[model samples]
Target chain A: MRAGAAGLAVWPRWRPVHDNGELKSGETTMAYSEKVVDHYNNPRNVGTLDKNSAEVGTGLVGAPECGDVMRLQIRVNAETQVIEEAKFKTFGCGSAIASSSLATEWIQGRTIDDALSIKNTDIVKELSLPPVKIHCSVLAEDAIRAAIGDWRKKNGAE
Target chain B: MAKRVESAVAAACPGCAAAQEGRALFCAQCGRIQPPPGCDYFTVFGLRPHLNLDAAALEREFHGLSRRLHPDRFIRAGAQEKEWSLADTALVNDAYRTLKDPLRRTEYVLKLSGTWGGPGKEKTPADLLEEVFELNMEVDEARAAKQAGKDERAQRTGLEAARARVAEMVEGLDRELRAQWPAWDAGAEDTRRSAERAMALLVERRRYLSNLVREVDEILGE
Candidate 1:
């Protein structure tokens, strides 16, 4: 009985918790950020934009020399400054895909200023990305800012 | 197998009455020599005979062709046809790999246009010769210093400094190429000779930078 009691004491008291109405697992897992991995495995907004649209902002960044090419587009309402839609097509590795996806998700329904304010570091933190993949998020964030800047320039808004 | 033979004969020698059987070198009726299988890289890819090209467009075209002509898609073909397919695919991959990188592309273009020979085999540009000579001398001095077991720190520092200089030169040449690209694309026929001259300079610059980078990489073991 004493040996069994000692064994029980040594064993970690594993208990699932309710944190902010969501269940939290006690065990450590090596699984990647589910949202980022999902987007990487199955990418969204993978296509070109309609250049004819006046309300669209198109930003093409990255070089093949760098082994990455990304194109980001945002459709915004002229007066409201709200992002109606966001899309991206990237030719890069899994990190790039996840970055693009995260950027798309962050920008939808947000104002141009809000979208531009979203930093690469924030994306990195949210996705729990490693150091090597931080640049992918930076590129995505740069694309978002570039697209917004283009939109504002087109509309003659400072 | 028989079907493939018929198709190959028809494809290679259209409208020939006498279709030679089983890899014959000559036509039975006309006695004319048959051309070799597989087209040249330029002909097959439909690219102009130039060193400079749009890399993005080349990649897109390569992927499109690969989807259709890859050997994996020709598994049902007989031995000879499969062999041709594999060889052709390999050639395509090689061409794309060589053409994608700017320095290799320049060297290949020079060779194709009958201007430059192999590595360290061409005349150095007059303006660059002195600097190139100086850099080579510096590299040799550093190597000698390391061999003598004296001033190892200084030798290593000199090597790193030389590598940095080469990296800066590479960046400058890359910038020049980027600046010249749009103008080259939009230039008038009368300005084409000047554009070609500018392109030749860029190509030479790329060659110099590539050699420098290779030397640095070898020393650094990178």
Candidate 2:
């Protein structure tokens, strides 16, 4: 309700002011990787999937530390159990956006079980996420597992 | 100079070598400023570590200390006394700022007691995760409508409604936080720890929801 509270990061418009930019005095700045910048600028599969559909599984997760929320959905082939489409909407810093964008790209066309193998470390390595931003990659990995879990629960596959 | 003043304990006053019992910023005997005490803010005010306090009394005490410790009053004093005055004033100012506000005072108590780890140290509870995610979805929809430049009134109405709901939620959380004060202030160790955990979560949840409401207000006002 206070004036400055609105400035906290939420989604879309208020990008991380200094995620890949300036640093406050006495703090060191780390440049985002070129790949992270690219994915953030043109994020892939940024939207929602049909939550009501039997074949669609939605995963919603958040990191309270930075107040980042990510929702990822996957549409699976009923017979093949392969993820045919993946979409994501991430409200976070550049590292988070890049991680989720890359997640959608990696999970699509892979079977749900295979997608489950994707690790936060892989995203971290791919995006060159600094130590401080590693949690964003972990969040992306959690979203993948949550989506798969949701699909399994809906399918009674357990 | 101020850093050194903060780090050392002024056990004895440099001006008159009077014995100081606790970490007090001014010598009782000599009435001269001492080093900024190596103590918590509550100690600076000579109060017990507690959440509830008399705000009026605190303000009066702060003003009285500020006036006495003002550097201008120390201009003709010894150089060391002058430096001590500046350092002690800054310390009192920091202490007062942290203690005057309810939320900040709660956070400072938890931090001093080592019961609450800062953000990123603990796993966010699942319920808060769901609430925050859903709130973001609504915020995103409002933001999208505003960006698209379509159905302006509908967007404004939706945002206003959402803002009202979030404000109500924040009020609820504030009450919940306040309810834990008794356990924190007087209970046994187990009860205090549980109260600490609950209070910490409540604080974080309140912060997130209030931030969402602020964002909605900004969109509506724009």
What is the i-RMS of every prediction? Answer: 24.6, 8.1
lDDT tens per residue, model 1, A51-79: 45879897655421122445688999998
Model 2 ranges off by over 4 Å? A1-41, A49-60, A72-86, A93-158, B1-6, B18-22, B76-87
Best by lDDT: 2
Residue A97's lDDT in candidate 1: 67
Tell me the docking grade of candidate 1.
incorrect
Writing each residue's lDDT as its tens digit, candidate 1 over B1-222 gives: 000111233334332666545233334576433332333344445666444586677888688767766657667866665665555565567667666766555545444544444223333344463355345446645655665677878878888888888888878887776565555456665454465556556666554454555555555552
In terms of DockQ, the best-performing candidate is: 2
**Per-prediction tally of clashes:** 0, 0
lDDT of 1 at B80: 61
- lDDT digits (tens) for residues A20-86 of candidate 2: 1123343334477889877777778888788888899988877654567788999999899999999
- Scored against the true structure, residue A148 in model 2 reaches a CA lDDT of 90
